[model samples]
Target: MAEVVTSGAVARTVEDLSGPRGLPVVGNLPALVRGGRPHRTLEEWCDRFGPTFRMSMGRTPAVVTADPAVIARIHRQRPDDFQRSAHVSGVIDELGGHGVFTAEGDEWRRLRKMATQALNMAYLRQYFSTITLVTDRLKRRWDAAAESGRAVDVLDDLMRYTLDVTSGLAMGHDLNSLEQTGDGLHRRLPLLFPEIGRRINAPVPYRRRVRLPRDRRLDATVREIDALVRDRFAEAARRMEGGGEPANFLEALVAPLEGESPITHDEVFGNVLTMLLAGEDTTSSTAAWAVHYLAGHPEAQRRVRAEADEVLGEHAFPPDPAAVGRMKYAEAVVTEAQRLRPVAPYIATQPLHDVTFETEQGPLLVEKGTPIFSLHAYGARRDTVRFPDPEAFRPERWLEGALPPESLPFAPFGGGPRFCPGRNLAVVEATIVVATACRGFDLEPDHSAGPVGERASFTAFPVNLRVRLSARR
Candidate 1:
């Protein structure tokens, strides 16, 4: 309904997507590098030039969209037109061939379908105890610190919780990551995961040409994790052969799919590695943001605690999935937190074939091989058309239906068919973690650091968060 701005009238140097660029080959690489976080800069571009816009990341042409309709059409209606970027695809291939997250085409489809079975509505119930167990452990750690009259590094503790939950789901066994120490195999896995993502995204020639020190370390870590996963799969296979009950995701995956390899040894390893890496960091970051925001908003925190008390009552953690579902305010808090701080800020997609589509605004024609990125979590949220007073944290907006569900206005978990399969798990994990923490812990913002900010790595996390926590009075 509002007039969309164009690059001609705007002061920015990058070429606009709406019109043919009158620019040179070097493209916007220099400007992109100077802009610091690329997602924020892309958001600025969307603000200046409607939802669909363009820029060049090096010689590669990139189209960015904030409009939900455009994103949906691109991902659902015209999915065949798009493919994972070569950079991302190559990285995945190197990590593990055709793992669900990395694989495309039939390989991705089949693997995703199989993976979903483990994470489906039915299997999720099995994780309730694990989530509660891990969160309860974290609460005790925080309580111990409170008794000692010491400040807690909430980030570190939350990561421990995430690692424990991830290990439980992936391996059918808890690693007690919250109590883990030493630079041994268990610790190396989490450390290497995000660093691999960073290395993959890094524009380093040495990433492909020669092994950097970190690369070698990452390779060694992957091998170690692979061995662990292989051993687990072998044990599961033996148990299944001996007629044992299925207990974890690894077992489900290893179980047969009539026409397919139930799960290859590498597939098992890849899935385990994928789950461990993705599960921990993203949820941990979401939990971190949840604590940060609630601490800053006492009234909201009180409401969250009140709901937790009613739903979970006297329990140290959320009771069960059914009970967790009843805590609407808890869900809203996590949603709002994620809306403000999505872990994966921006995602890149390249088209396998040229495509054209029509929208309420106008027609879009993306040439074959063009790299398009959707800034799903940035200005898209703060955009007035998408969310009113978008900068403010108001959990009630969701209850009030201030924003439409179909709107791509806030895609912390992304949009379309490619929308994150793990989103449901993430929501559940965040709600329980935040609600339980508020019930027993008094978290205060670390004012000494001025304000907690972030560095966009594989996931966006608090760059230097130092918060003080004490027992709830």
Candidate 2:
């Protein structure tokens, strides 16, 4: 029932695809900018042009798809054929070098293996105390803010919490950004990620063409970040050489220097940047959005609190990883939050070879070099057909006896080989934060201010999220 069309050297003709036609050279740019967020615009287009369509950003051709089957196929079958788009990879490589997040093929494989070993479940279990310490510090700060009876910036506080946890776990240093008041490396580090996102989505290649003021600032900030990470890596290496046990990611990376196919110092540096950038924004944004959702739904919040209290009875301060695992309802809350508000909205990939995607409409031949934007967040996770009552905040949907087949249309962490290596860590970290926060305090939205809106940076986060917290009775 599907028609296949092939032209000379190319796969499908431009007319074969359905999408918006824009002005000359800058196709779809205006629509994307006017819609504010590209993923939202793509979702609108998906509604208009079926599940799959073609659009252009400037002169670059792209295939946009909302179909879970197509997305799953692309993710599962053709991982080697599809990789990060040039623009996305270029921006990330420029900022963080060729780490696991940006690397392709064999380089990615090597870096991913090392990163996996470094942040494996065992390592995360070991690092639980570090996460607990940082989270306790965050709780203390919230306690102070609660006493003031003023709305606190939820995203900012969660960012500080994630920064402390990530820096402490990865670098073996406590930034204490939650309590510290000065503009230190911890503060400056977050600025780089958003800027990177801006550059990636910019219509004009300003970062490549000319040295803008922001570019210079990014360079300076990156230099500071690099110096701090390098020093920490060196110190970690020194400790490892002195017969000290490897305590953190840096030390874990250094410990394998004597192993076969050991990662280099430069790889260590790049991976450290990768972990910091990837770890902080995604986990913090998930936690913030989860809190926002829970604030609006008091019954759900009460359920989560009850579950936390039941699971983490006496040792709730620094919850053991095993105990944390037993908090099913809490995990369900985090999972549902992720389903509603995915941190990375779109996953961009480019085909290295000609490929044909089987769509419900037909078989579409995709040529090499065509950028494929899998609008995973809007397309799959929020698809009303896939998820009944997609807009509702229902953590029970993730509890046992809810959905049996968890594949397709539910890839919060993307899919296939490039599935987020830090998936477990992110989920565990968010679960701990949510469970601890719910058990310790009641969070209410600051109705004096307007409702929190969503913003797409490197990750999608709730913008201007201010919440009033009170100690639980």
Candidate 3:
């Protein structure tokens, strides 16, 4: 591991870091374009340049690292000395605007406090019934596919399931995106995150200057989402006027506090959008990948099913927190799946001041505005130095008695203060969904749609993931 020099020491320069110096004007853009996925390209660069290196995005200087120590240090300094890169935050601002996810400094602190209160353990406990209801809808959808003996698009179903859960938890309403068809809001929600990702990585700020067809559609979609959220806020406000306590996240945000000023209407709208984007894509992607892994690994599947049977007995319909807690192996399975395929593949941060970054090679100086990309998925799961047989799915790695060392690179939900607050909810939701689905049916991958590949949208998710369900006795 690279050692950080003492505070007063001179910082290193970009020339000191190991990385390819591409064309004069374009820098690494051509290579990135040729390499397809940015994370994979960066991972390959890590292999060649050791754990830390320098790269460029157009004229902007960037540093890429997969070193856990370096990533931990960066995360620890978040919002103080290290903040979300301007490019990343700019994209999110355009999509969701100044919510908890995109806010920084005092604003971020305030939003985080409110959001954490709304999504805390107590609130999560209240969400179990809602989760169960959503899962029941998913079960019925899968059952129909099972009876038809046709492969179902698991990713699509899982996305719908998550959307339903998020809607119920965030707004106390049931969009029924899973059961309903041709819902404009449901269709548009998925596009928002991917478009944000596209704009963030685009070579030019084309959308800023002109509204292309896709940009026009995205604008319309965002307006629709805004209208829906605004209506929910109004409804919640009316209910509060009638002396009702807050029932959902929207209400929680807008409900008056004894001391603090009430959150503005715009804040409520922004945070609601944040919740939907954060909750839907990340949870669904992780669950779908877990299903994919379980489908391919029958032994693991059997173990999870057996564990689910013991924990859930004959009533696995609404997985209560207690029941989900008891399914240790099932939790391990989900953890392992997340280890292999983290939904949010990277964490991007920028230093607030000149900083010395510890790396495998040595301590390197990073300029204040340079974007630093920590490849979380690759670092935690695929690094040969940390995880043995990095490519294999081994749930035992996360079992209670067999857990890996805490120091090992295992950041599925990031690290430090910036760690995802929704992690517990995501894990619990995935565990319930996976255990329930596996208990009810055996899954077989439909590889005829071509190999199960990963596509990087707002989250990394399984692409072409079709699975045939065989009802279990």
CA shift at 26, candidate 2, in angstroms? 1.2
Model 1 residue-pair collision total: 0
Query: Would you list the C-alpha lDDT of every candidate in the order shown?
Result: 0.72, 0.80, 0.81
Q: Arrange candidates by lDDT, highest first: which order? A: 3, 2, 1
Q: Return the clash pairs for model 3, or none.
A: none
Question: How well does model 3 score by local distance difference test?
Answer: 0.81
Worst 10-residue lDDT window, candidate 2? 1-10
Question: Which residue window of length 10 is worst by lDDT in model 3?
Answer: 1-10
Q: Mind giving the per-residue lDDT tens digits that candidate 3 earns over 75-109?
A: 78888999988887888787656698888898888
Candidate of highest lDDT: 3
List model 1 lDDT by residue over 128-218, tens digit each.
Answer: 7888888778878877887887766666777888888888888877788776666666577667656755655555546777888888887
Best-performing candidate as measured by TM-score = 3
Q: Candidate 2: give the clashing pairs.
A: none
TM-score leaderboard ranking: 3, 2, 1
Kindly report which residue stretches of model 3 are placed more than 4 angstroms away from their true locations once superposed: 1-11, 33-35, 256-258, 382-386, 404-408
| Residue ranges of candidate 1 with Cα displaced over 4 Å | 1-27, 33-36, 359-361, 401-406
> How well does each candidate superpose onto the true structure, as a TM-score?
0.90, 0.94, 0.94
Clashing pairs in model 1, backbone N/Cα/C closer than 3 A? none
